[model samples]
Target chain A: MHIIIVGCGRVGAQLAQILSSEGHNVVIVDKNQESFKRLGADFNGITITGVGFDPDILKRAGIERADALAAVTNGDNSNIMVSQIAKRIYNVPRVLTRIYDPLRADIYKKFGLNTIGTTTLVAHIFRSALLKESAKHEFTIGNDIGLVEYRVEEEETAAKESGGGKK
Target chain B: MYVLIVGGGKVGYSLARRLADEGFDASLVEKEERMAKRIAEDLEQVLVIAGDGCDPGRLEDAGIARAQVVAAVTGDDEDNLIICQLARDTFGVPRVIARVNNPSNEITFKKLGIDTVSSTTIISKLIEEEATIGDIFTLLALKRGKLSIVELIIGPKAPAADKMIKELRLPADSILATIVRESHIIFAKGETVLKPGDSIIALATTDSEMALREALLGKE
Candidate 1:
């Protein structure tokens, strides 16, 4: 499997190294040349320095033939843009995006995007560990399915914030 | 209407100035302290807020709840999108406009129900318009085939050059409407002479288009 990663942060670099070591093709993209240092001198995966979401850059990074794409950029918007391009434009079968803001992450999920939020995950885990009953979860679909649900007033907050204007 | 603008870059600064000049309530937010300060040098400080637009605290202080139109024109497409979404989802701003740096993201922005101003699309269109005049240009087309307005330049080697419009055997259905020579508009008439380096705008039918071209260049 060929995987394309859009960031050169720790997670992105480590993921690329691991995936390449596992015998899967890996291509890592970063705008700054310095970020490639994270992948280490022994890394074998391809490293591309350019705007991650640029069509030309993605093409050079093998996005057209990539089996999966992970947008782990620091900015929620950048990650979302990269993910959307990978999904809607290239039709990558597997696309994942990382969002820092939990609210914004939830909103994108409503639009049918696979997203992960670091702050959301950490806070939920912290709460579950500290207080079992204080955990933010709803009933699971079945005993075998562990569905994680957070009690966020997304709909009401959205309607209220629109200040009774056009929904 | 009250307008809240994020990103005090060229677009935001110019738009705020124009809006202020037009007597509308406008405020601008810039994440960079230097940018906000520089913009505040010309505009009122009250109208310029130095803070991250994505932060709800900053948005509330910038009066996002009262913003009728929110335009995020930052350089980063993602930042602009997040700012607009925050304004809409957090404060319920009625109208949210986001600037899209990538043309491919325009469809995604639209699909997510966000109105986007795509700089890539605008730039591409401008380039396309400029290159259209490089060769044969179709100005207008009437119906499906009745008439087509075309513009072409007369080269020095063309046979029609240095000839009077009256002498040229232009088809009955084809008429030379105007001639542009060195930035001057010359109404084409029978006695008007054609010269090299002249842009001719003509109205011709589909069947006569080839004949018009052949007559103008003296070639089939």
Candidate 2:
């Protein structure tokens, strides 16, 4: 599949490498030519130095035939704008964007764009690993619905033993 | 298979409802009579019983011995722990999952041989971190924040495409762990050439998500 990645930052670069290694056509767009230097001498994909949201830049990145688009730039607005263009104008089958603010996640979701919040995902990791004794408040299964996993600990015992069962 | 969930709170109700929707044999035991009645009214197939989840008698009454997996998701951490222990030790349920409200209590639960989830703490932290850090995929956290698993999908315009995995001078702190293509998962190797549509899973420090992404997808 042909994939276009806007933003040459950490997420975009890594995503490009992953897809490239998997044997798919990949193109990366960025504003700075120096950013491509980070990919090193052996890197093997097309790198376009231009604003990701610019239509001309996208066309140069082969957005017309792209199957998917990922907007993971540092700025949320830029990511959203690029993703919208990719989905609406370019007609990419799949479009994903990195949303820094969790509050805006719902707004993006309503537009049918897949959003991933870096902070929320990370915090969940830390909390799960660090806080294991407190009463679990919520658990989710799959992306939509599946088996939600949770941990049972001491506070739960006190609630059951002292709180008394169903009065 | 009869799935017994101990707790009638949001998690329990949601689980019961979802399982029921999937055509599973699900039941809930809520110690509070009112909560039990409410859950019973809300669910069509779930059998809601008001009883102490930790009590062996209550579990037996809920047919714990015949349950495929006993989930303890009561609001209280202690109650969940006891229910899980009893389910494993006394009732002999094959699978038991407990909810941990406090993130700090995870180790104790693990030592007790029960799976635990600090969903609230973790989810809140996730939201907080996303608000602060701005970029990078957290992937899966491990060792209480000491490690993480992140993924970055190669983009069409990236510089690393068409090059062998060994050719790219990846940072020392990061390692390309797996390559996903067309839903097929492959281990990363030196001879492997990165292509478009490939998803790369890597293990690195929390701060490295952005760097990894830049390395794999950033443009010139």
Candidate 1 local lDDT, B124-172, one digit each (tens): 8558646633445668878743688989788898778999999999988
Candidate 1: chain B TM-score equals: 0.60
Instruction: Tell me the lDDT of model 2 at A56.
Output: 76
The CAPRI-style docking tier of model 1 reads incorrect
**Count: clashes, candidate 2:** 93
Worst 10 residues of 1 chain B by lDDT: B128-137
Candidate 1's DockQ: 0.21
Clashing pairs in 1: A161-B91, A161-B92, A162-B92
Q: Is the docking of candidate 2 incorrect, acceptable, medium or high quality?
A: incorrect
Kindly report which residue stretches of model 1 are placed more than 4 angstroms away from their true locations once superposed.
A130-167, B37-41, B55-69, B84-220
Question: For residues A1-167, what per-residue lDDT tens digits would candidate 1 score against the true structure?
Answer: 99999999998999999998999899999999899999998799999998887778888988889899999877777888788778877899888888887766766665556777677666655565554333355322112223354433534221111111121
